[model samples]
Target chain A: MDREALFQQIKKKNSYLCIGLDTDLEKIPQHLRSTADPIFEFNKQIIDATHEYCVAYKPNIAFYEALGPKGWESLQKTMDYIPKGLFTIADAKRGDIGNTSALYARTFFEYFNFDSVTVAPYMGEDSVKPFLYKDKWVILLAHTSNPGSSDFQLIESVVTGRKLYEEVLLKSQRWATPDQLMYVVGATQAEKMESIRAQAPEHFFLVPGIGAQGGDLKMVSQYGMNAQCGLLVNSARAIIYASNGQDFAQRARQEAVNVRDEMARHLQDYYK
Target chain B: MDREALFQQIKKKNSYLCIGLDTDLEKIPQHLRSTADPIFEFNKQIIDATHEYCVAYKPNIAFYEALGPKGWESLQKTMDYIPKGLFTIADAKRGDIGNTSALYARTFFEYFNFDSVTVAPYMGEDSVKPFLYKDKWVILLAHTSNPGSSDFQLIESVVTGRKLYEEVLLKSQRWATPDQLMYVVGATQAEKMESIRAQAPEHFFLVPGIGAQGGDLKMVSQYGMNAQCGLLVNSARAIIYASNGQDFAQRARQEAVNVRDEMARHLQDYYK
Candidate 1:
């Protein structure tokens, strides 16, 4: 899925929301628990209910990995269950050497069939380069919203006189085109949105910390958005475990609809 | 395990070697191909033969993850095959937000049962803090040997007038003690080894880029060594795929012994 296709989907649905499949075993509904693959069963219902209303699904790999071997089985099943048109992300923050990283690209892009994967850039270009395959996005970590982001990433570099995150943005962009590269700029860092935009004006951003992290969607849309509606705002806990009851899928859909409606308003403003 | 325990083991075996279980399915012996799980079987045999000669086994997670669900199954089996006392690493360079990172910690330390996992410190303290559990090690990416590592990591920081990698080292030490944190200083970057040691005088380093990447084990030991002989020099391709014949296990043992002998010479110099 390319950026233009993603934008069209956002326009068609009038939503820029990406459902986070941070699926935990113990938190899943009881009805699905009896099934051989509870995580997949739950994901199927949620995807079926909410696919039309959203453009993407970001599955946090750690959740599936925590269940040991069984969690991985569920993750594979869940990946298969996601519709073809909707963008899929194996939210596995993987980064390593060039040769090893090439294998990671094969893992998510070829084996599990994901459109993208999150990566840490601390290992520099070689670690992130292998994943920048044709049409597949590599969402590099930049100016995150977490509190300790200020510790090292926000520090100013004496050489370039730019923040560390800015240097990552500048250096990594040379490795891949905007079509293959995206950045993860947190929604809670709304104040720094304009500066982030100034750094990499063309790339899309996979923005988390929207709902459960209490980042205001209005503030995010106001400052962080681009001409292409270059944002895939993710909400994990807010949509997945909205209700732990048997009506979990139904509540998830309702929560998703609320986000989509707000996003529609943001899209309308984009035209203005 | 703590520094004392690891040092004691290294002394007992007379080896500073850490065999990298970068087990690729296509690279394993053809005889193991017919086994129920070729990857796991290959790892088991290699571990069985080389366990006595090496201090630790580092399984790069990308290889297993590429096989999809079955690959993960092989990873768990391989982890189980490693003896209780032998240190195991997930080689998963995972780093995220505080809440998400907490779950990643549980995935490796609790579920997969690895003693340590690699992490990228580009996102700063919050990204790394979650992985520092009671008795686990969080190996942060420091001076990587990749060509583009100087892109951002080597930048001089305005605040400290220190290189970005040095900043990562100085700031990250505040989050965890030397026991809980380690650095990934590439073996190829031997020229900078003494400077890295001066900045991070006490922390252990997980050194890669040896053998296959042409990093000199001799130079790395000379400058990168600390009071505890604090270096885990990894050789993946040169050791594991020493041969593809039925005598693969014997060849692997010999290759491991070679690296161990070189490391022993380094440690001997430190003792003198």
Candidate 2:
């Protein structure tokens, strides 16, 4: 999806919420375990119950990948099942050399047909450039939510005097515009978001680490929002795994509604 | 495979040559295109022809992943087909959060039974630690071969005065021992290999960019090799796509023999 289309979805839904389908077989409802493809079945119900409450679905690829060929089948089925209008993010942190990365771009953007795929910036320009198609988005990892993110990303560059993540934000801008590129600025780094916002004023930030990771949505929305409501706040475990009983889908919808309602209030206040 | 076992393989074969199975439908011979699983068929023939000349098989995951579920099936078949003693490297270059990384580790290690998987160090310790299992290896990207490697990796850190890749090498060592840890020190960055060898003397270095990418084998061997012959120099297109006809597998075998011969000479000179 393009920048304006995504913005319109946020305006229409009154929520910048992106539900993460980090579905694991071990964590799903006991009844669904009997199904032929429990992962896809679980994702289908989650989408049905909560599609209206969010504008995007981010499926963490590892969960599907762990299941082997069947997992790939489940992921393909889930991709086919998600509602067309909702922006889909393949939370597959993939990046490689030029030729290999082009194949990955084809994998996610063409084969699986995700609207966007998250990419790691450790490999640099050529690795990321292949994913920058006209409508498809490259959500580059800038400042990640994990504690290990501080390892290299926070290191100060002698030449630029910018921290590594800041350099990522600054240098990657040269590769792609705000239209095709977005930053994965973790919600846990709320204080850093203000400075990050200043660095990439127009680019949308896919904000992970909200619910399960204990990131405050209000603080993230307040500091990270732009005129176009440039933030896609992701909630994974806290929403999807709200209940492991038969009421899992219903409980997930309730959790989604609670988050969406809060996002709606934030849209009115911070999304100018 | 463990460090001593891998070194023993090098001693037994007199080759540290790693052939990369970057099998693409468009690039393989036309005859194989008619097969039920062309990718797997092509890989099987290539492995049949070249297995003895190379100690390791690095299947670039992007090629398999591009074909979706069927592609994954081909990968599993190829993994199953590879002879037991030969080392296997999943050139996936995948790393995420702790939980996600664990799933990826499981996907490559348990599900597919790869000896090692390449990991990008952008997310840091927790992202890499999960892959450092007993006998399984985490081949971290150090100085990559691409032109863009100069972009972020070469950036000097103000605090440490070391390059970003240097910091990665130093910090990642604290996460895993040489037994379970390796580094993807691209052969294109041969000039930097000496210092890299100094920083990571014991750990194995899975070097790419040798044949098709024009990295000099002698220079890479001179600077990168250690007591255990700590270099698995990879050549994907140069060996695999040597021909596109019925002579393809034979040509691939010839290329593998050429690389293996050179690697044997280097092993005699450099394996201390």
Candidate 3:
């Protein structure tokens, strides 16, 4: 999906929600485990129930990877099931050298057909450059939601007198435009959003650390919003794992709708 | 494999060579393409031919992943077939937030049973901590071999006056001991290895960019090697793609022997 189509989805849906399918076998409903393919069945229902309320779906690749070949199969099925008009983010934080990274770009972009794949910036330009195709995105990891994010990201750079994450934002732009590149800034660190927005105002920010992760959405939108509504606030566990019963899908939709309503208000207030 | 076990393998084989099984379908022998599983077949032959010479086998995950589910199956079979006592490194440069990272650790370690998996440190302590397990290693990307390594890694940090990669080496050490950790300092940048060794001399360095990428082995060993022969210099294309005919395995074995012979001299000079 291109910048305009994604922005249009947000305008039409009145939500900048990106629902994460961090589906785990053990975490899915007990009743569904008896089904032929429980993981895919779970995701299928979740997409069917909640696709209307969100503009994107982010599937955390690790959840599928842990199950081996079968897990990949489940992921493929889930990818095949998600409705069009909803952007897909393969929350697979992959990066490597030039030749190797090109293969990864092929995996997510061509093999799996995700709109974008999250990439780690630690490997620098060549590793990430392969993931930037027309309308496809390379959502680079910035200041992440996890506490471990503080390990290297907060270190101040001597040359620029900026934090490592800030340097990441400033230097990485040389590789791709705002349209092809985005950053994964944690919603938990919403206070930093204003400054991060200042660094790359046009690029969309894929914000995790919401709901179950305890990020305040209003604060995130208040600081992070741009003219194009440059934010994709992701909610995974809180929405997908809302219920373990057969009512799981319905509960997930309810959760998404509730979040969507809040996001819709933010979109209206900011844009109007 | 544990540190001592790895050391023993190095001594027993008279080599610290880590053969990169970046087996691409198109790159494999054309005759093997007629086989049901060409990638795995190519890898099996290469492993059989070269296992005695090299202490480790690093499968670049992107190569396998590009082929989709069948590619993963080939990887599983290849993993199952690698002889015991030889170390396995999943060169999947994967990192994510805490919970998601845990799933990735499970994917490479538990599901695939790799001795270690390469991790990118962009997300910080928690993202990488999950990959360190009993006898399993977390090989972090330090000064990479790529020209792009100069991109973010060489940037000087304001607080410490150390480059970003230097900070990564210092700060990341607190998360895991030398036993559970290794750093990938590229062979092409052998000049920097002297100071890199000064940072954490006790930990092993997984050096790539040797053969096809044009990294000098002697210089890398001279600067990087410690008392324990702390280097696993990798050569992927030059060895594996040495021949594309019926004699491919023989040529691969010959290439491994040549690299192994050089590594033996380094081990003797460094340790003795």
Candidate 4:
């Protein structure tokens, strides 16, 4: 999906919410387990109930991969089921050397049909440059929401007195415009959002760390949202696993409604 | 495998060669294309011919993933077929937030039974620490073999006047011991290998770019190689895709033998 289309969805829905389909076998409703594929069944119901409240859905690939070949089949089913126009993200943090990266690009963009895939930037421009095919987005990791993110991303670069993420934001502009590229700015670091936006104002920020990670939605929106409403605030367990019983899908819809209502207010209050 | 087991494999084989199984359906010999699973068939033949010459097999995950679900099945078959004691690496550069990363660790290490999986360090310590479970190894990306390695890795850090890769090597040492952790030092940057070894003396280095990428065996061995012959020199295209004709597996065996012979000499010359 293009930037204009994505922003249009955000406005039309009045929410920049991206529900994370981080479904696990042990975490799903027990009644669904006897079905042909429980993971797909769970996701199908959750997407059906909550798709209207969110602008996108991100299926964390690791969750599917843990199930082996059958898991990938379930993932394909879920991807196929999600309604079009709701942007899809393969939340797989994949990046490799140039030649190998092309196969990954094909796996997600061509085979899986995701609109974007999160990528690690430690290997630099060549590793990430392959994902910049026409229209498909490359969401580069800047300052992630994890504690380990400080391990390398927070280090200040001597070449330029900027932190590694600042350099990533500043240097990666040469690769693509805001239309083709985005950045993963963990919502936990909302204070840093102002500074992060200062570095790359136009680029969309796929912000995780909101619900389970203790990040305040208001603060993140206050600091990060742009004129285009450049934020994809993701909530996984807080939305999808809101309940584990037969009412799991109903409870999930309720949670998504509450979160999207808050998000919609933020879009109206902050986005110009 | 543990550190002693890996070192023993190198000593027993007299080769630190890691054969990269970047199997492609279109690239395999025409005769094998008619098989039910040509990729696995090609890998079975290659492993049969060259397992004696190499200590490890690194299957570039992107190759199989490009084919969708069946590709993963072929990968599971190839993984199951490799003879015991030969180290297996899921050449899937995968890492994510803490919980998500745990799933990736389970996917490659527990589910697929790979000895180790390469991880990108952009996300930091927590992203890497989970992969250190049991005896499974975390081959951290230190200095890659691509031109883009210079983009972020070679950038000098202002915090302590160190390069980005240096901080990665130094900080990551605190996360796991040498038994569980390894580093990826690209063969293309042989000059930097000496400094890299200084930061990480005991840890094994997974060196790629040896044959096809024009990295010299002699130069990489000179700067790398600890007392344990601490290097797994990988040659992908130069060994696996040595020929595209009917004698493909035979030619691949010859290529592996040639690379492993040179690697064996390096081990002999450096080790006490």
For all predictions in the order shown, the interface RMSD in Å is 1.4, 0.8, 1.2, 1.0
Candidate 3: tens digits of C-alpha lDDT, residues B1-272: 88888888888989988989999888888999999999999999999999999999999998988887898899999999999998999999887757778888888998889999898888888877888789999999988878788878887867678888898899989989999999988865555888899999899999887763233888888898887778898888999999999999999999899888877887788777
Give candidate 2's fnat, 2 decimals.
0.86
Off by over 4 Å in 3: A188-191, A212-215, B188-190, B212-215
TM-scores, one per candidate: 0.96, 0.98, 0.97, 0.97
| Model 4 per-residue lDDT tens digits across residues B1-272 | 89999999999999988999999987888999999999999999999999999999999999988988899899999999999999999899886767788999988888889999999888888778889888899999998878888889988877688888888899899989999999989876566888888889999999887663234778888898888888898888887788999899999999888777777677777874
Among incorrect, acceptable, medium and high, the docking class of model 4 is high
Candidate 2 displacement at residue B255 in angstroms = 1.0
Most accurate candidate by lDDT: 2
The residue pairs found clashing in candidate 3 are A157-B158, A158-B157, A158-B158
- lDDT score, candidate 4, position B121: 87
Off by over 4 Å in 1: A189-191, A212-215, B188-191, B212-215
What is candidate 3's DockQ? 0.82
TM-scores, chain A, per candidate: 0.96, 0.97, 0.97, 0.97
Kindly report the interface RMSD of candidate 2, rounded to 1 decimal.
0.8
Q: Is the docking of candidate 3 incorrect, acceptable, medium or high quality?
A: high
User: Residue B6 lDDT in model 3?
Assistant: 86
Provide chain B's TM-score, model 2.
0.97
- DockQ of prediction 2: 0.87
Candidate 4, position A72, lDDT: 93
Cα deviation of B42, candidate 1, in Å: 1.6
- Clash-forming residue pairs, model 2: none
- Those runs of model 2 whose alpha carbons end farther than 4 Å from true positions after fitting are A212-215, B212-215
